[model samples]
Target: MRYACPTPGCPTTAPTRTTRCEQCTRRNSRAHKITLVCGPPCSGKNTWVAKHAQPGDLIVDLDALYTAVNANPTRTDHDQPAALTPFAFDARDAITNRLLHGDHNLRAAWIIHSAPEAATRAEWKQRGANIVMITADQDTLTHRAQVQRPNQWGEHIQDWHRRYTLGHVDRTVTTG
Candidate 1:
């Protein structure tokens, strides 16, 4: 069976066994459904991903991908933010290819904090995904993140609070 290439610029026929043609296979192999969970750091995105994603579900975590790209399984140094950007793009590309190919019945999530995230959310929705935005109040988020990691909440807590105050989050679902 043959399938159409999901990427806009690519003109190729994808096989049913694989969502991508030979030219795109390497990138398409990772394609799947994306459920973006955007919030401040420690906003339970990982917890939600763990809870909702099934066994075959793909998880495109920026942090994890960054660590993998850096070849550091244990990225203990929090100050090296610059080292993570390239890996983040690689992971994003992989995830985008997967979404285009529809290679797996994927349920994935992203923890974002910018306008670009909104665009990403729109793109996923256009792809016929069920976008569920999860949100919580500043105090609650701080409390949870503090419970999860005491020292890490300094910057992320303020960012989340600011985003919440500015109403940056859209189509959000408040959950306990």
Candidate 2:
């Protein structure tokens, strides 16, 4: 059973954290139906998913999963999994794969993203996934970031704006 790296932009796969390649995590496979929720941080991706996702609808938000399993849910740490540190992304990716394949009587899935490259979005679109993007001006992003995260939300917003250039998408929401 080969697993995939859930971390964005890192496609290298490994067996497990113990024996898997030092690149990405690995786990069971299912087909992949992913709805890419594209937006900047603090742009209401989590809020939108919370409002939209019904029960039994698979949600693949990495930070939320990490928070669910960790004492400090808000801790934004990735890649370096220490002995007993938080490393729930493996589980997230595995479950996401299952959801995409519609395993165990699954239905739709929501995947929150931070401005995926156009090619990446196109790949998912080809796999029969939907894309939802929440966008706003830089000022709005900065204000929302201050209200939501305050520490680095502004930087993340800038990053998203700089990275987002995809032309074709299923839906676009202009958030203010």
Candidate 3:
């Protein structure tokens, strides 16, 4: 007994009921796209995702997670106490791990991170993620930090620029 691959336009066949051919199976598994928006603090990573993301899309952002866990309903900014950083990080990791599984009901997943190392971007690529680097000049970022979070975010902005290295995924988006 033989079974034809159920995938449309796929001509492969198997001797047993293997739902789809190897090629189609691999392609299907990667149907859900994971996009990582990376850059320094105040680089508009969250804004970029907000502009592009649609309903049913999963968004994993540490700052947003932190705000949620902070449980401050009146909070209108991304600032969170340093004590809650670890907890927010753990939540982000859990969500990211689940997204990496490639079996979620989400249409797409967007992760906002400050990934400054080539190795980090390479790993994300290996896991079928698209890297989008949102950036701005150092002065602009520093100024934005000062205006937004003052002493809290300026150092992080400077650190990101010092460590960032353009990798194979050079989809850079300059933001104001």
RMSD values, in order shown: 6.7, 9.9, 6.2
Q: Which candidate is the best by lDDT?
A: 3
Q: Give the TM-score ranking, best first.
A: 3, 2, 1
Residue 14 accuracy (lDDT) in model 3: 56
Q: Candidate 2 on 63-133: residue-level lDDT in tens? A: 66655676654565431224323356677667756654444555557888665478767766655678887
C-alpha positional error of residue 137 in candidate 1 after TM-score superposition, expressed in Å: 1.3
Supply the global lDDT for candidate 2.
0.64
When summed lDDT is taken over every stretch of 10 residues in candidate 1, the lowest stretch is: 107-116
| Model 2 residue 111 CA deviation in Å | 1.1
For residue 169, model 3's alpha carbon misses the true position, in angstroms, by: 1.8
Score each candidate by Cα lDDT: 0.57, 0.64, 0.80
Q: What shift in Å separates residue 166 of candidate 3 from its native position after superposition?
A: 3.1
- CA lDDT of 138 in candidate 1? 68
lDDT of 3: 0.80
